[model samples]
Target: MKLPNTAHTSRPWRIHEIAHDFLLEDVWALPTPGGPDDFPRLVRQMTSGSNTNDSRAYTALFEIRWRLGKLFGWDRPDAGIVARVPSLRDRLPADLLAGPRGPVFSSVPFTSVYQTDDEWVAEMANRTVHALMHMSWVADEGGGYHGQMAVLVKPNGWFGRGYMAAIKPIRYLVVYPALLRMIGRTWELQAAG
Candidate 1:
């Protein structure tokens, strides 16, 4: 479900240290309730599943975004990480760098940043923004654990700011709601099996 920005900001996440300049765009309470060890399963499901295909509208939205990026050179090589902006890895402390760099995504463009038993982070960048997707397994009051997802972004400049503004309504109104339902459905299937 869509959660308040404080849902993420109030947590003592290591991401806060590195993403000080980025905005906390969104946070959602994922429906994948399970034991603490189930985080890897969540990560694996996310990496391998095609959540955007859950609905025609979702697929169309993604296609339109991809086409726009291609046409406008928003995702061009020179516009990405280590090209236009320095990677968040550069800011990581020695301990985080020495640990296992998380899983490589199978379908998306994100690169692993770090992974621990309770938390995982991945990053991606384009002309519009340098973004981070953070997932954490948090203990629920009811005795089990559930997943939480937060998106953080540092917009490139004026174009970035404009692009973010234009997409805000669509993102919150359509994309995120569908995404939450998709995650719930997938988690049910995964748990059943």
Candidate 2:
């Protein structure tokens, strides 16, 4: 479900230290409830590609986005991370740099920034923006844990700002609801698998 931006900003996340300049674009409560130790399972399911793989609607949106990007050169390799903008990896502190940086994603263009038992972060960039997808395991008062996701972005310029504005309604109305349902269904299926 969509959450107030404060749901992420209120947390003492390590990401705050690295992505301080990025805007908190969206926060959502993921329905993947489980034990504290089950975070790895969540990570596994995500990296396995089940979320987008299983949902035709969700996949269609991405396909459309990619096709548009190709038409407009929005996703040109040089327009992405390590080229257009500096990587967040460059900002990592010594301890974070030394730790596991998480799994490489084969399903998407994002690169891992860090992974802990409770949190995982991946970053990506295109001509329009540099973005981060941060997943965190949050403890409920009753001892169960659920996943939370926050998106951070730094828009490239006037075009970037306009692009974000144009996509905001579509993102919130169509993309996110489809994504939430897809994630919930996949979370349950992973438990069965």
Candidate 3:
């Protein structure tokens, strides 16, 4: 991985820097496989539109894998979707649930820590798994930091705003309300305990 000169002064936003800073030394020991074969297909299904299974899988492979490339110190984020480690399911930080919403945080640095093209993809897959399983069971949608660049499918002038409006109902009504319920349950469970 190429170290950024800027990284010397402050945290760099480049994917390589993010990976090196956050994921270094930790990723190699992760349980994920070395390449594409290890990625989770279930994640693709949750995020993709009505594209063919292969196409959806392929797209997930490319985007998530690209993100993973930075984690390993590769120059380009790369392309292609791939599997992640099962250990990714190990646990989310309890702090991830502490935010006002549901712990949806992101940063350029987070993308870089994936260690390989597939690791990023796997992390995304893990996010989707959380979204699917707990989309309605938490307070914030990962603390309202639902990841970045994932929503910019066609970020044209009006396209972005229009897309936001189209999904506004779902975002505010369905997802948010469901998230409240999820968070409520957690509190309730803790209270019961």
Candidate 4:
């Protein structure tokens, strides 16, 4: 299934810009703060829960990237950043490639390359956006915004039910805009302070 079109006209949360920014930051982040060893470490850190074949690794990595991006300053939730990590995963070394069925999972690596890139800024914005999008799950139902909590470990289903379930407030009216504003302001605050 294809994701919603994000071209011209009215945008979805202005997510297209966010996506572009995320990719730019990601390209740079990959080389500077996280190179060969660090990238592999990040991969291991995020893919710890599953057998590598499960798409859960992708989701988990997105979550970790979001947290790191926020801490660093990139917080836009861009589509490019979402696409980049997986691109990186697609290009992993032979030894690093592991899956439940071995060959079945080898085709997808380096998906993270879809992020935004600013040769000058080194994709910092893209990385931040990537991280924020992943963290949507935590911000949506972590008791601060919503009264009730869900205990869903695996957020994958036939029709994106799991994805929709996980991204409650981010997809809704309340939490997403707040996060966007807060993180965007944080970038300014960091610059000013």
| lDDT tens per residue, model 4, 24-134 | 111001111222222232232222322222234445655775676578644444434334233333443343334221111122221222211110001212431223222
Q: Name model 3 segments beyond 4 Å from true.
A: 1-157
Model 4 scores a TM of 0.26
Candidate RMSDs in Å, in order, are 1.2, 1.4, 17.7, 17.7
- What is the alpha-carbon lDDT for the whole of candidate 2? 0.88
| Candidate 2 Cα outliers beyond 4 Å, as residue runs | 52-56
Highest TM-score, which number? 1
Off by over 4 Å in 1: 50-52
| Pairs in clash, predicted candidate 1 | none
Cα lDDT tens digits, model 3, 1-193, are: 1123332223222233222322221111111111233222212322332222223434454466457546643333222113332222233334322322212223211221122212232233221121112111111223321111111111223633464456556544454344334333433343346
In candidate 1, how many Å is residue 193 off?
1.3
Cα lDDT tens digits, model 2, 1-193, are: 8889988999888999989999999999998989989888877776766784465766788899999999999999999988899889899999888998988786888888899878889999999999999999999878899999899999999999999999998898778888888888989887878
Give a tens-digit lDDT track for model 1, residues 13-125: 88888889989899999999999789998888777754434677877999999999999999998988899888889999898899978877887788888877778888999
- Order the candidates by TM-score, highest first — what do you get? 1, 2, 4, 3
Instruction: Name the candidate, 1 or 3, with the larger lDDT value.
Output: 1
Poorest lDDT segment (10 consecutive residues) of candidate 1:
45-54
